[model samples]
Target chain A: DAMVIQNPRYQVTQFGKPVTLSCSQTLNHNVMYWYQQKSSQAPKLLFHYYDKDFNNEADTPDNFQSRRPNTSFCFLDIRSPGLGDAAMYLCATSRTARDEKLFFGSGTQLSVL
Target chain B: QQQVKQSPQSLIVQKGGISIINCAYENTAFDYFPWYQQFPGKGPALLIAIRPDVSEKKEGRFTISFNKSAKQFSLHIMDSQPGDSATYFCAPLSGSARQLTFGSGTQLTVLP
Candidate 1:
């Protein structure tokens, strides 16, 4: 089945330490996105890569960055993990920029101690 | 800015009952609206969706009612079961460059 996959289901990091979450997709979707979801809350868009063009949400802090090495893989990097940054980081991909149906990976649960 | 709002942050229903979730949106970027279901410790899965051109769409016990004029839509789950308990999110997509803008989410608990 064509699906999105994320590595390290649970990640623990010290405050101020940096961490990276990995994502890969077999769906070959051109648009990959990263979202932050806190407990019982909505998933907030952090940024996305539509092909090679990166689109970042205005309110997304400078601490979060993303890299799409190719069409099938994407990575999210936290320059400095903060306590408030502890949440589920979800990786999703759609067929195209106009495609709204997203396939999401099982997410990396980040814990910043 | 696009904002999706959902009501009833949490709901409790008995098996064989119907579960209803309402949503309203502001500044919708596209006509497509979808509901995602997420279980504990799992990624969200697409449950159902509707387009503005249609008033209602149904697959099995799940139904989606769309009201374009009111900028509102809803998901109706018939014959609610314990297995159906999960968090539901109302997300309208194509917003901010064709991405989903998800609502806060409603935790549904269906008791047997």
Candidate 2:
């Protein structure tokens, strides 16, 4: 089935260490997004790639960064992991930035120790 | 101020009963209202969505009642079952930004 996929479903990193979460899709969607969802909270958009155009949320911390080398792949890099950074990282895609619907991946659960 | 507000931070519903989740939003250039269901350790899945022009849209057991004038919308799950339990979020878009903003989220538990 063509779907969004995230690797390392569960990740553990030491405090202040760098970590990377990955996402890929077979959907061939041009818009890819990264969301951070904490316990009992809604998913928060960190940044997104609208066909190579990187749009970052104003509130997103500098520690969080994303890269989309191509249409099928995207990556989230944490410059320095913190306890507060531990959360489920979700990847989503849309055929176009204006489309109303989204396709999501299972998510990468990060644990900062 | 939160752009989108969803009610009943959490809910417990019996099997075969109706599960209703409500959300209200401040008017903007927003055009799409989407409801998502997320299971533990998983990403959210789009259950159903509605446009401001429509009052209601239904799919199978799920229904979205959108009141554009009142700036509110709701999700009604009919004949709820245990497998229907999940966290729901109402993320309305400002045409297309940051998902515009996300609702706090509601955790639903359907008892079997």
Candidate 3:
């Protein structure tokens, strides 16, 4: 089945340490997105890649960065993990950067100690 | 300001009952609305969606009621079951950017 896959279902990082979460998709979607969801809250948009162009949300912190090496792979890098950064990170893909259904991975839970 | 607002942060319903979750959006540019369901420790999956041009769309027991004039939409689960217990989020899709603005989410529990 074509779907989104995220590596390291659970991750633990020390404070100020750098951590990376990865996502891959077999859907061959042109648009990929990263979302941060805290406990009992909505998933907030961090950034997304439309084809190869990186689009960052205005409120996204500088500590968070994203990279799309190719259409099938995208990476989320946290330069300095803070305690508040601990949450579930979700990766989603869509056929286009317009109104369309999204395919999401199981998600990676980050715990900053 | 939050672009999307959802109500009734939590709800409990009996099996065979009806479950309703409501959401409102302030963005007029939003022409697409989708509802996602997420279970514990899993990512959200698309359940049902509705376009502003239509007032309602249904798939099996899941239904989406959209009101373009009111800028609101709702998800209704018919004959709710224990397996239907999960968190539901209403997200509005807007622009060529396709960035989805999600509501806070509603946690629904269906007791058997």
DockQ, every prediction: 0.84, 0.76, 0.84
Per-model C-alpha RMSD: 1.5, 1.2, 1.1
Model 2 stretches with alpha carbons more than 4 Å out: B96-100
Relative to the true structure, candidate 2 reaches a TM of 0.96
Kindly list the per-residue Cα lDDT of model 1 for residues A1-113, writing each as its tens digit: 63999999999999999999999999988899899999988888999988999999999999999999899889999999999999999999889888878888999999999
Q: Estimate, for each residue in B1-112, the C-alpha lDDT of model 1 and write its tens digit.
A: 5478898899999999999999999865667899999999788889999988899999999999999889999999999999999999998876555677788899999999
lDDT of the candidates, in the order given:
0.91, 0.90, 0.93
Estimate, for each residue in A3-112, the C-alpha lDDT of model 2 and write its tens digit.
99999899999999999999999998989999999999898888888899999889999999888888899999999999999999999999987787888999999999
Candidate 1 Cα errors over 4 Å, as ranges? B94-96
**Which residue pairs show backbone clashes in model 1?**
none
Q: What's the i-RMS for candidate 1 in angstroms?
A: 0.8
Worst 10 residues of 1 chain A by lDDT: A1-10
Best model number under lDDT? 3
Q: Quickly count the clashes in candidate 3.
A: 0
TM-score of each: 0.96, 0.96, 0.97
Task: Evaluate candidate 1 and give its CAPRI docking class based on DockQ.
Answer: high
